[model samples]
Target: MVLDSLGKSLRGVLQKIARGSTVDEALLAEVVRDIQRALLQADVNVQLSLDLTKRVRTRATTEKPPAGASLRDFLIRIIYEEIRGILGKERPFDLKPKRILLAGLFGQGKTTTAGKLARYFQKKGVRVGLVAADVHRPAAVDQLEQLALKVGCEFYSNRAERRAEVIVQEALAHFPAHLAVIVDTAGRSGIDPDLIAELKRVRAVLQPDETLLVLDAAMGQTAGRSAQAFHEAVGLTGVILTKMDGSAKGGGALSAVSASGAPILFLGTGEHIDEFERFEPTRFVSRLLGMGDIQTLLERFDELSDKESAEKAAQNLMSGRFTLRDMRSQLASLGEMGPMSKLMSLFPGIGAAKVDQKTLDATQQRLRRFRSIMDSMTGEELDNPHVIKADRVHRIARGSGQKPQEVRGLLKHYESTKKAAHGLVSNRRLRRQLEKQFGNAEAPAD
Candidate 1:
């Protein structure tokens, strides 16, 4: 939910378009004004926002909708294109056997992003290695070593070496054959001559394939200046915006960095090492405007579970045979997809729903507790919840360290969820809509 306020404001404008009987000049003007206001409030550069809205307005009024497309849909497309243009083209980071040097100011999350990048490539079937070149930070080497162990990747650093260049050389020598090395460089409090000099030395020695500048999303309009400085010093291949999940100025940072002509390569979505993702401008803007990103959602599902398993789970839900075990598996899948708010944002219309994070967290916690309680149940009770009578519920409660009423609540939830799933499966219109939205890929047979 980066730039949450901006998303809300743009969604409101789209709602106005949806409500209007026709797309008229007045409506277009209103939409432009609203978008401009939203972008400015998100701390975007004023001139950039104005230019973008102008393009949107011109396209909406002059261009004709596609034969089957509605006027509202055409208008939305124009806005989407204009916003996507401002965000620049997507620059995908390919995980290969090459050295990647990370650079940025202090507290911009460069060290953490280095860890995340290593984990990302490791997940992509690469033998990844991390070289902690941040000799200035007291515990930076230790932090990268711990993250390497956590992700089961190779780690290289030299505490005795005072020069980062020497550390880089030593780390490269020790790296396993064909391993992709990510060098975590030190950052200064500000972009200073000393910092740039140190980075230049490291860069010359490492000869990295990619030099990425990590900028804090909360840096707002200043992100452009920082990116420009790094680009000048190290010839940056791309930029990585960090702390994107919590930054209100995320919009500004993204737009500003894009304006600097360095395509955003990735985003630090959360604190978890696995939360980083490759940046795709079109998909990102689509989700930002509440158009849904099915590809990303599907990728999440694929990461957490195999295709056959997911298809089987879907079949179970459709057939109304969802058991407590199935429910627990679903809960675990949801947990792996990060926060509910973020997952919901990837779904069209659902992002507009006013869901409180506290409520979402509480619901997730309840699901985990339910799973724990189910673990305490007998196998037959999980498969056939109706077999769990009052006495059995009491036993489960005692085993799970909860009251009997709580155990009963879990059973009630299962029943309700099953009923809802049956209702959805029975709705042909809903099925057709999903097929149309997500394409007609058939699920595995029940």
Candidate 2:
């Protein structure tokens, strides 16, 4: 949901186009104007925004729609291409075991990114190690060590050594074989002379496979200048934009960095280490245009729940045997996928529907509360909710620190869900459709 305001504006433009009786020059002009306004308000460079909209206009007017495509589809395709162009090509990271050096300005999340990057590769089945070479910051080494422990990665550091180069050499010497070493370098408030000198020293010794510059998404237009400075200093292989989930200036930072010639390799979506993801320009633009990102969604689901578990859950629901325990597991899986608003944004038409943020937030809160209530329930209560009478409801509410009405509401939801699930389980036509969709044998009717 980064650059949410801009997404809303772009969605509005598309809606207006879809509603138009005809596609004409005037309509194209209005669409272009709306796009320009949205990009500008998102803090995009004026020239970049103008150039993008101009290209969109030319293509929409001159090029004919594909044989089977409508004018609206063609116009939408043009806009998608233009936006993708500004975002630049996707630079995929090689998860192979290799040394990576992280560089950035102070408070740009370089230390945290080092941890996240390690976790990303670890999840990909790579043996990763963290080397803390940030000797200047008092807590840098400790923070990296804590993160390494939290992610279950090897940690290497030296509190006694004042020289970063010496510390890095020692850490590398002690680094475990077959594990990828991620070296964390010191950063300053700005690109100061001392910081540059120290980074150069570390780079010379480490000779890392990838030198990644971490940039803050909220830096806006200044991101380009910062990127250029780091590129000139250490010859960056790629950039990682951090704090993307909460930044309104994410679009500007992304465009500016892409324009500077260093492709964005990953986006730090949230504070959690698992929130990191490799940047994909095409899929990203699709999601921004209100088209679903099925690839990413499937990847997230795969990460949260294995194939066997998913199949088991589906079978249980289809058999009308779902319990409070099953519902809690499902909720946990969804929570791992990140915010509901973000997940919904990946659904086609949902983004354009302009769902209120408050509503999404409330739904997420309610689901969490329901999980909490379930946690307080006894095994027998989870197995058979019908056994819970008025007295049980009061006890459960007190145990969960929730109102009695809230407890009743959860039971109501469970009943409704159970009824719908039974209906689906019994419908022959629906079972056939599901079988076709999943390419699996149909289960016997419950």
Models 1 onward score TM values of: 0.66, 0.66
User: Per-residue lDDT of 1-446 in model 2, one digit per residue for the tens?
Assistant: 76688988887788777667788889999999999999998889999999999899888877886444468756866786678779876666778999898999899999999999999888899989899999888699989999999899999988889899898888788877888999998888899889888988988888889989999999988999899888987798999999998788888899999999998999999998888888877667766766444345445655655745555655677887777767767777777777787887655445456679899889988998898899999999988888999999999999999999999999999888777775544443442332332222122211
Error of 2 at 41 (Å): 1.9
Give the per-residue lDDT of model 1 (tens digit) for 163-269: 99999999888877899989998888888899989989998999999999999898988999889888887799999999888788888899999989998999998
Q: Find the candidate with the highest lDDT and give its number.
A: 2
Q: What overall lDDT goes with each candidate model?
A: 0.81, 0.81
lDDT of residue 261 for candidate 1: 90
Runs of candidate 1 with Cα error greater than 4 angstroms are 293-446
- Candidate 2 least-lDDT 10 residues: 437-446
Model 2 regions more than 4 Å off: 293-446
